[model samples]
Target: MTDAVLHPDSVRARKADVPVVLGADGAPVDWVKVFLGFGGMVVGQFMAMLDIQIVASSLTQIQSGIGATADEISWVQTIYLLAEVVVMPLTAYLTKMWGTRNFYVVAVIGFIITSVAVGLSSSVAMMIVFRALQGLFAGAMIPPVFATAMTVFPPERRITANVIVGLIVTLSSTIGPTLGGHLTDLLSWRWLFFINIPVGLLVIFLVGRYANFDKGDPSLSKGVDWWGLGLMTAFLLSMQFVLEEGNDEGWFDDGMILWLTVTAVLTGIAFIWRQLVYWQPIVSLAPFRDRNFSLGIVMTFVTGLSLFGGTFLMPIFLGQVRGFSSAEVGNTMLVSGLTMFLSAPIAGRIVRMMDLRISMILGFALAAWAIQLGARVTDEWGFWEFFTLQVARGLGTMVAMIAAQQMSVASLPVTMMKDASGLINLIRNVGGAIGLALLTTILSHQTAVHYMDIATAASTANAASTGLMDGLTQVMGARGAADPEGMAAKAMSAMIRREASVLSFGDAFAALALGCWVAMALAFFTRPVKVDTGRPQGGGH
Candidate 1:
């Protein structure tokens, strides 16, 4: 294999005398195997993501079914996300402690078990606990899913693998709500949990059958960073508390939020210090030394805001504001999911040939454009506009996401690959949670401001919009048709409320546009690397 590097026109570089293999640089790889492996991991990933939103969609029904309050029902989702975020960093260690194979197997099984438990549960508490448990073990599914595809395929073939991976991840995130809603509406809400059973079992069976590979135990072999794990978990938990409950508690006004804020800060500082100073960190921080890895985190974080935030907004806006059924919300999001599936592989293909920086730049450009499209929401807008925007977002997501994901790992040492992937993805998950909470709160605030603004404007009684009292009378009549006088008063109030909703939704859409502007900075952080191939110009395969 003694070969000299020679530039080539077909690709960036060509191997001198390496064995000519299929999709190995210039050779094609075992794409069928790679896609099968990638697809299996994606199934696992989609199931995990589906769980997060499925709970939210089912909560109202579950709440009534189980006799729970709004606060109590929130736990269905909160528990899953909390477990998912908490388990994310831990999964890296588990992968090393066990092996990627054993880890994924265990993860898939645990997910299936929990999914079933959640479905068969007798009470909400039991379901929450099982859901949390599902979140915990299933956390191992994501990063490893990507790593499996990368490992199975050669460099040239990496594009194909990522396209599949990207499609799965994109669909899981974008279409989760739609899928959740469908399962909830047509079937019992419990079907959401039950659905994962068959899919997860299939994934597990496939991995056992085809995706077999070692998940090296670096912790036992490498020694567990016990102290680091505990500290990081504490830090994440504290931060989550602040973000999840801050608005409810009036920000700093609540003692619990204040305490959690302080704990998060202190624990976070300690965690970082231990990582930098310790010779053997719990989760190694060296991969982050790669500028690409750091940039990847930034990109994933900002991108998460748009991805998760939009997904959260649509259902709530459609259902809470427009009074659409759960199924309708699902149908709306299905467009985004399908579009992402279509766009990912294409983005993956071109990304391999393009400069890392160039691909990332283009990806962000698409993402920014998508956000601009979403910023024009109106109460009266039809499904087509929503579908168009979601598809654009989906397209932008694949380009930016896969580009960011691949570039981050390309330069890392093979040994740190799995852990590094986990860390970068951990940042993305945390970012998604934070994004959801932040945007929801922002949407809430903006809606209020817009509502009041519109209400104030209407008080004087314009030709187009009557006074608030008058609008209320008309809406009350519509809402409460039993008593004429009472209905008139209620109708008047409801008209004002509908006007408030329109203004609020518009304001929320505009507010989210600002976050996309911040995410555009991710393009700047990416380093430009010239493309390289595994060959010399005239070398034989």
Candidate 2:
């Protein structure tokens, strides 16, 4: 019942050559309890990651439910992301203060309370407030799982642990919209938040009972860096705001975006300076000193860019260009989710067999190739066309993710695992945010440019244009339209817009492919890390 009984001291070698993990009391601990505790935390993490995209599919329903305007409704997601980014890096500090079990359970409790509040909300303001709280709590649940995967399992079992973690992280995000759509259709948007209740309660029980990997250091509170915390919160929140809203608000042309960009830069610089100079920084920058960790963070960022960017783009294409409903879009996107699930075990095998860098490069190359295939996208493309693309993407994401996850933490001492985990996860989320912003900007600019070029070429002087116009006019006349010629012109203009949109999508896909290729090149720079087969020294409970 005590921490000593739940989480053993560390791994010890026996005369029989079997490695047994000992508890705080130096007694052998049950691996089953450790696995179950870690599993509970993983489930909690899945719930946190799932909320990021679940509401995306049913934003309209939620908007109406909360009586929000279209513009105001977007804040439902934006506020959550902003709050989450602010809290993610600070999780390491909190975990060290409260220990893994207490921090995780408290987070789940906070998440559950806010979920219920969000579901019961009657106004946009109330919903946003609760959503921000939910995100803050949910953010605390993510990093510890990554750290635990590396620390709790020995090197022999690390690959399998990484695979499960990688699969859950990617699969949950990939399937979020699909599940959200079905839930909304079967019930309502409120169910999205309501559904977290039972699952959260279960996580609480499991984690409370079995998560005893570490004990709280109450002494850490004395040196808490309040200044650094303030700087980081301001920096991350401002930066996230700029990334989330810059595209819609016309980037630097908008005053708010411009000011926020400046604020973000200044505070970000200050935060870095404070972290370097301050004795006890809120979030440690020590993880960057590890060559593998630094390189792994970069790869992790690219993985997030491709994963989130691809997820964002496909639904837009399906819904806008293909005229698919939310449920239909979800169904179509399931290809990528299923592929990710299937490829996880294979990814584990590949990571185990091949050099980590080689595995990472292969994954990035496959992702680039898949996105490059999407560059040939046409308005007529459907499920089958995207099916091939999704398969490659799913495989590439899983493999790259497992490699990146391992490389990020493998080189760090156990003492730094929590800090490293927080930083890596934060970078990935930031990468996703930046990717969405860049892709959205590209889609907008290219659409207008392509539309103008196409419109200019489709003039009356062109025989093809004239002939098509005439045919459309005749068809409209036969259909008894009053303004047949004018309607034909309008129809031609709409067609041009649709074509322009498709072309822009191709350009965006090309951009994502370029990102993947760049990441592939960067993978070569990472230093190789030794497989960790024994207990990490000096950091165990």
Measured with C-alpha atoms, the lDDT of residue 96 in candidate 1 is 65
lDDT of 1 at 354: 67
lDDT of 1 by residue, 1-541 (tens): 1011111222333366332333224443333544565577778887777667556655787888777788878877777777777877766667667766677878899888888898888777887788789888777787787666555544665556667766666666655666676787798888988888788888887766655444364546565567778899899888876777788778788888888899999989999998888776767788878887887778777667666777677777788766887567767777777787877767776576666666767777776676666566676765787877777777776777777777777766556766777787688777777877777677777767766776677666577554545565666567776675666555555766776666666656665666655656666766654333342212112
lDDT for each candidate structure = 0.69, 0.88
User: Per-residue lDDT of 33-137 in model 2, one digit per residue for the tens?
Assistant: 888899999999999999988998899899888789999999999999988899999888888888889999999999999999999999999999999999999
Instruction: Name the weakest run of 10 consecutive residues (lDDT summed) in model 2.
Output: 532-541
Q: Give the lDDT of residue 389 in candidate 1.
A: 75
Off by over 4 Å in 2: 1-10, 14-19, 532-541
User: What's the TM-score of each model vs. the native?
Assistant: 0.83, 0.94
lDDT of 1 at 3: 12
Assess the local accuracy of residue 32 in candidate 1 as a C-alpha lDDT between 0 and 100. Answer: 51
Cα deviation of 278, candidate 1, in Å? 2.2
